[model samples]
Target: MDGTKALYYGAVALVILIGISVVLSVISAIIGLATAVISGIVTLAVLVGIGYVAYKAGSWLLGDDDSASLDSIGTGSSSTSVDAGSSRQDRLRKQYVEGQISEAEFERRIGDELETEEIDDIDRELERER
Candidate 1:
């Protein structure tokens, strides 16, 4: 009876040890996978940053007028890309708020936009009269 009890206890301990080992193995695999994923993401971001910098440098060196950066790559005209009417005002306002343009620059650009709109209305009226 004593030998039988000792054997039973030894079997239970062995099973528990195997269970713990399996759990640790699974945890190690998960940690390794997470590390690999993070490394890949960081590498991708760095590559993109370098590419963008190179593109900007090349454009500057070549004296290219297309200053969209990453905004509208193949779009020729800057004005049309931003849409027409009030949306134009909204874009200017957004730029100003984002510190891309100074207060004076914002005021000047907005004034120019308003003038252009008024001139367009006048042109349409004159054409209608004709």
Candidate 2:
């Protein structure tokens, strides 16, 4: 081919190659951006989960747990009011008031009542709900 035609064709080929490179770079940038966005979201979600767990641990450690109390040694349910707590307790209280049961026996029975009642009541309540 003549020198002018050769140079013109070479320039055209170079321009085409540059155009392809630009298009490929643009596609690569878009993919990279998408990957970055997805990773950021995952990191944020993991961090939030960790933060929530930490908050619960802190609350429990600081004696802020609302489940167990001095009076009630079990999960306190606010929505479902337990109308009658362990009937055994009522009888014990009545006996104590009537001076039939000794103070020591009354205390021991009350303790036993609380322990058994906590387990049975919570299990029955959960089972009923389920």
Candidate 3:
């Protein structure tokens, strides 16, 4: 009789566990749906904000005023691309000239900078993909 009672109790416990699982699953699904909806709404709001800012900037730039000097707004200087090695050398030269660092220390730092790897394999792979 005790064996039969234990079997009945085990069956009840399994049913209870299944019911709890189903309820928790439903709650989790609701939460997940809510999160997705909230994120989408937030993304849409950010995109709209960006579009509004761009529109305002375009209108402002297109407005004609006789006294507005484009040269005053920008220095209009182009930039040159320098490699890592040359950039390090340039910094060393500047420091030495500025008297902030000694020649010997600048030489040591330049050697260390040039000898180290600036871009690893992963960075190279990403650059290649681009």
Candidate 4:
């Protein structure tokens, strides 16, 4: 079964087991020690069974692949790296379009293509202008 169904059934079983334990505890108090021991064993077994099912379901939801570990999945090994420089270029282009910089200033800053030097020059000029 799916993880959700497994978890739902497991939780329901746990609740039923707890209710039975409580009822048995009350009965044992009225009767004797044997009922209490039996209830305790049943409760322990049910809890262990639930725990094992939950663990298996969790493992199934998370892929079985070794690379599915959180650290490994998020590491640079999986997919494309974001171009940090592109964000800066995008910001500069937006500012230029928003009339934050003069045409000459924008052209001079964004000249030819997006290079580190151009971004640095724009930053320096913007700082000086401010």
- The digit string of per-residue lDDT tens for model 1 on 65-130 reads 365543355333434534586798999999999999999999999999999888866765675578
Question: Each candidate: what lDDT?
Answer: 0.83, 0.81, 0.73, 0.71
Give the lDDT of residue 104 in candidate 1. Answer: 100
Ranking by lDDT: 1, 2, 3, 4
* Model 2 misplaced regions, further than 4 Å: 66-80, 83-130
User: How many residue pairs clash in all the candidates, one count each?
Assistant: 0, 0, 0, 0
Candidate 4 residue lDDT tens string, 4-51: 999999999999999999999998787767777889999999999999
Candidate 2: Cα lDDT at 40: 100
Residue lDDT tens for model 3, 19-118? 9999999999999999999999999999999998888787688973333444344321111122545776888899999999998998898877755534
- lDDT winner: 1
Model 2 — TM-score against the truth? 0.51
RMSD of each: 10.3, 13.3, 17.8, 22.5
Q: lDDT score of model 4?
A: 0.71
Clashing pairs in 2: none
Q: Can you tell me which runs of candidate 4 are displaced by over 4 Å?
A: 1-31, 65-130
lDDT of 2 by residue, 77-119 (tens): 5323343455667889999999999999999989987887688
